[model samples]
Target: MDWNDRFAASGPGEPGPPSVLVGREDLVPTTGRALDVACGRGTVAVWLAQRGLVVDALDAAPAGLALGRAAADAAAVTVHWIEADLDEGLPVTGGYDVVVCQRFRDPALYPALAGVLAPGGLLVVTVLSVVGDAGGRFRAEPGELRGAFADLDVLVDEEGGGEAHLVARLD
Candidate 1:
């Protein structure tokens, strides 16, 4: 099913905050621009806004973006919500102090993701992985994120329980 249909079926509910950012709060800058790619329901984007960052949240599903807009409004934070398909490549370019892509895997976008970061910017990413689980078409193989983001100074890299997480900073 398409994302719009999937989100429509799921109905209304916040997805809560990003656990990756929660665990590594110290790594996140209090001010500057941030982008949350494939930002469903805007949890991470709103959270970043609350932390004093100007945030841009992108998602292809209108239903999801609507839910995200409501969530952002409820939180009394402002987020620029962009509806764009990542398969077409990143809609915006460069100068983000933080870029987050959680639970979304598109290896093709890795270079663009890295390119958007300002110097010393933080990147937080998490995705389904083959580690400790059966491999699937959507899952990343072991060390996939590390290999893809090797140019960054990786601070955290952990994989298990069918998921992989990475927090890195660009030089």
Candidate 2:
């Protein structure tokens, strides 16, 4: 199903920390700007706002953004939700303290992710992998994340069970 239709059929659930940050929330700074690209339902956006960061979350689906808005409201935090097509490139500009891209893969945008990081900024990403599952067109091959962001100081890099997660910091 298309993203809009899928989100339209779903509810705005509670916002949770991004998967890569589940037990490593300390890596996040309490101040400064954050961006959640492909922020489906705005879960990471609301979660970042709750942590006291100015957050901007973007996705192509209006229905997903609407659900994200509801989730943000329920969390009592403000998030600048933007409906934008990532295929057109990032809608916002400037460096950010945190940049998160979860469950989305776009090798073409990898450098842009690093380019928008402020000094000491953190980048968290999770994507489907070919490591331990049937490979698909959308899955990253071995060493893709680490290789893609080799310039950054990698804090965490792991791949298994058809998933890859990476957490890196800009020096």
Candidate 3:
């Protein structure tokens, strides 16, 4: 089944902040633009809008975008939701104060993430990884995120329990 089918079959709770930024929301700027790549169900995107950032959320599934739009309306926030596949390249333009890509791993787009960051912008990314688990084609390798985004000042870098997450800021 496609992502749209998967999301249609699922019933998830309300959108929330990126899991990587749960306790460290201070890393997010309150008044600048934000982008969420592969923004499934618009969870993190809507949450960013609630935090006072203008948000752009992109996903491959229209069902997921609809879910996000509902959550945004429920929260009385605005988010620009776009349905597009990231394999083609990032569909948005200009710099953003924050960029978030959770549970999506695309090495080819790593540089674009940094390129889209405004000065001092924060980047939060989480992907399945080889660390502490049997590896899969979709998982990141050890130090993959750090090496891809070495230009950024690393704030949080962790790999374990089948996941890798990085939180960094542009210098």
The top-ranked prediction according to lDDT is: 2
Q: Give the 10-residue window scoring lowest on summed lDDT in candidate 1.
A: 12-21
Off by over 4 Å in 3: none
Shift of residue 31 alpha carbon in model 1, Å: 0.3
Please give the TM-score that candidate 1 achieves against the real structure.
0.94
Better of 1 and 2 by lDDT: 2
Q: What is the lDDT of residue 19 in candidate 3?
A: 72
TM-score of each: 0.94, 0.97, 0.97
What is the per-residue lDDT of model 2 for residues 19-114, given as tens digits with 9 covering 90 to 100?
778888999999999999999888889999999999999999999899999988888999999888888888788689999999989999898888
Model 1 alpha-carbon drift over 4 Å, by segment: 12-16
Report the Cα lDDT for residue 128, model 2.
97
Write down the lDDT of every candidate, Cα atoms only.
0.90, 0.92, 0.90
Task: Count clashes in each candidate, considering only residues at least 3 apart in sequence or on different chains.
Answer: 0, 0, 0
Which candidate order results from sorting by TM-score in descending order? Answer: 2, 3, 1
What lDDT, from 0 to 1, does candidate 2 have? 0.92
Any idea how many clashes model 3 has? Answer: 0
